[model samples]
Each structure stands twice: as C-alpha cells, then as structure tokens.
Target: MAGSENSKCRGLRWALIGSVTLNLLVAGVIVGGFVAHDRHPPRPVVGDVSLGAFTEALSPEDRDALRRAAQKRVGDFRDMRQAARTDMTALIAALQADPWNRAEVEQILARHKARTIDRVDIGEALIFERLEEMTPEERRAFAERLLKGAQRFDKRLDRDDNRPPRP
Candidate 1:
C-alpha cells in the first residue's frame, strides 16, 4: 500500500539521521581526546635519579654551572661513544671474516674489553667530578630529593598489580 511505503521511508530517514548524529558525536569525542592528550603529556621517569628535583634545589648560579658541566660531559660522551662504535664494528667484522683466527679474535676482544672499561671509568670520573663541585649541603639535599622521588614512584607502582615497574 502507499501508506506502508511512506512509513518505511520515514523509518529509514530517522535511522539515517540517528546514525549521522552518532558518528559526529564519536568524531567530536576522538578529537577532544587528542587535544586533551597533547595538552597534558606524561612526565619522563629516569629511574631514581630525580635530576629535575635535584636541579630545582640548586641556586641559579649552581644551576648554570651544572648546565655547563652537563654540556661538556655530554660532548665527551658522544665522542667516546663514536669511537667505541667504530672499534666494535671493526671487531665484529674480524669475528665474522672467513677463516677467522681465534688468537686474533681473542686479542681484539681483550683490547676492546679494556677500552670499554676505560670508557666506563672515565664516565664515572666525570660524574664524580660533578659531585665534587657541589657543596656538601647541596649533595645532602639532592640525596633527600632522590629519596622522596623514589617513595612517590613506589606508591604509584602499588596502584596497579598488573602494571610492570617503571624505569
């Protein structure tokens, strides 16, 4: 009947309108989530270091000195890393070469091991030098800040059993 056809058309139109409205609502929600996420990014966690907290406790002058020290240390570290990479690459090639000599590989590995140890020692020495630059009071305060941060980090871990520990 003509009446039945009219009813069917009306129903289809309403269903289409409802679907369009829902899709627009969902799109709005998705856009909102993205905006919100961008505005409030997660904070970086660096183990128990609390580098930010330690820096906040320092005076402006101390902070400037610390920045300079960090820049120098980073530059040195990059140079060392590059050298290490080159050495490691050479070692890998030697190890992979056809008809490799065990004695030669062993010698190369021993030398590489010594070089790596030296690099670690130098890095630690740099860190120690920075520590020495700070006053005893500053060092004590930094220790306290590190402790509090660790406590806060542990409490966050307790909130969810299924979640793995954060670095």
Candidate 2:
C-alpha cells in the first residue's frame, strides 16, 4: 500500500511539473510575440491603392519622391477617406432601413465609386510626374521591374485559380 501511494505521488508530481512547464512555454511565446510586435509595427499604406505593385518596382529615390508628393496632399486624401467612411455608414443604414431604398443605395455606391476614381487619379498624376522626371535609362529599368512584378502577380493568380474553393 505504501509503495502504491509513493507511485501515485510521483505521478501527481510529474503531472504538476508538466503543467507548469507547458504554462511557462505558452507565457514565453506570448511575451516574445509582444516584444516582436513592438519591434516591427505595421507600416501604413501611402499613395494609390491600385498601384501597389507598380510602386514596388520604383527606385527608392523615386518612391520617396512620390511619398513626399502624396504627403503634401495628405489632407485631400484624409478628407476623401473620411467621406468614404461617411458614405459607408450611410450605405449600411440604407441597407438596414425597414423599407429597402434601392435608389438610395445606388446613389451611395455611385458616390463611393467617384471618390475611388478621384483617389486613383491623384495617385496616377503623382506617378506620371515622377516618371517624367526620371532619365530614359531609369525609366527602362522601371519598366523591366514592372513587367517582372506583373508576371509574378499573374503566376500568383493562376495558382490561386487552381486552388479548391473554400466551403
């Protein structure tokens, strides 16, 4: 009976040790994640949303110039973003109305689309201006990089197309 009790006690002690070790591991992982997150916060997206791949192809100096230009017009972008948010709120309210107003929803969508176009236009203008300032050689290099980026994008799309649809 004593031997059996000793074995049981040993098992309980091992279980306790295992539980503590697992908790320590989890706590360490959580603390490490927090430290890593603090070290590398997410970067804000600047400039045209549609031109992300094209922007990536740009030289660092050209990219900086575009960023500076975008920053100069930050107020305009901010206003547009705020307007978009307001439009979205209105859209949701329209969707939730007791009597569905199709016309109201359509009008809100049209306004949202117009705002999007305006943002794209600003971004395109910035890109065009930067291109004009670049030397012919730089432009050629940029074109090559842009083509490569496009090819990569196409390949990714192809791979995604072949993937099974999610339930």
Candidate 3:
C-alpha cells in the first residue's frame, strides 16, 4: 500500500538524518578537541606522544629560549597537575563513601573541571606570551608545525579507533 511505502520512506529519511547529525557532532568534537589540545605540549602522562613540533622550525638559540621558559614554569605546572590529581582522588573517595549523592558528585566534577580549565588557560597564556616575543618568521613556522602536529595526532587517533586512514 502507498501508506506502507510512505511509512518506510519516512523511517529511512529519519534514519539518514539522524546518522548525518551524529557524524557531524562527532566531527565537531574531534576537531574542537584536537585544536584545543594541540595548542599545548602534551601532558606529562606516561604514554604521551611527542610532537617534536616547533623545534625543527626554530633556531637552536630560540629553541633553547623556549625550553628555558618552559623549564622555569615546570614546577608551577606540576603543582597545578598535582592539585587536579588531589581533587580527583578526593572525588573518587567521596564517590565510595556511604549514601552517594549525584548532586554532590556533579558539583565536585564541575569544580575539578574548572580547575583543569584554569590550568590550561595559564599554560596558553605563557605560550602566547612567548609567541608574542618571537620573530614573525618564527611565529609562522610554529603555526605550520602546530598544524602538522595536529594532523599527525588525528591520524594516530583514527588508527586507534580502527578507522580508515584519512585521505
């Protein structure tokens, strides 16, 4: 019957739309996360990937300068990361406590997330300040390196996800 056909067509159309929307959302998250994460050096995680990114584009002296700048603030970053770890530990412990409360967990998570964001903000500020002092050529080269690094990261993620290598 025409009505049956119409129903099937409607169902197919909705399925197609839903699939496309989901794909778009996933792509947006991937792109957004990549850009935000790529803006900084990797976290000091045990399995962190090394981008070796901007150093190839920099003069020895400039690279040294950047290294020194980062070195100077390493302790500060370590402290911030430690604070985040501490907060996470406390959250986990509370989650294990009697009478678990969803509201309390949400509040703790939000505060922990805010602190993490603040740490990133501080890191970005430092990088931006360093870039501001760089020569125009250096800034351009660094941008190129960052783009390449991000692309490499994307490919690695795709491989991990068992997706086809991007064209």
* lDDT on C-alpha atoms for all candidate structures: 0.61, 0.78, 0.64
What is candidate 2's local distance difference test score?
A: 0.78
- lDDT for each residue of candidate 2 in 71-116, tens digit (9 for 90 to 100): 8888888898678667766866776788967688779768867987
Judged by whole-model lDDT over C-alpha atoms, candidate 1 comes out at: 0.61
Q: Which should have the higher lDDT, number 1 or number 3?
A: 3
lDDT of 1 by residue, 1-167 (tens): 99999999799668645644553565567568667987877532211221444545555665555556555556555675566556555655665679755576567557656766775665455446767888888788767776887787788878677687799
Alpha-carbon runs more than 4 Å astray in model 2:
1-50, 157-167
Question: Which digits, one per residue and each the tens of the lDDT, describe model 3 over residues 124-160?
Answer: 6655667789888877877787788778889998888
Question: How many clashes (backbone N, Cα, C below 3 Å) per candidate?
Answer: 0, 0, 0
TM-score of each: 0.42, 0.64, 0.48
Q: Judging by TM-score, tell me the better candidate of 2 and 3.
A: 2
Model 3 lDDT vs. the true structure? Answer: 0.64
Q: When superposed on Cα atoms, how far off is each prediction in RMSD?
A: 22.2, 18.7, 12.9
Model number with the top lDDT: 2
List of clashing residue pairs for candidate 3:
none
Report the Cα lDDT for residue 132, model 3. 86
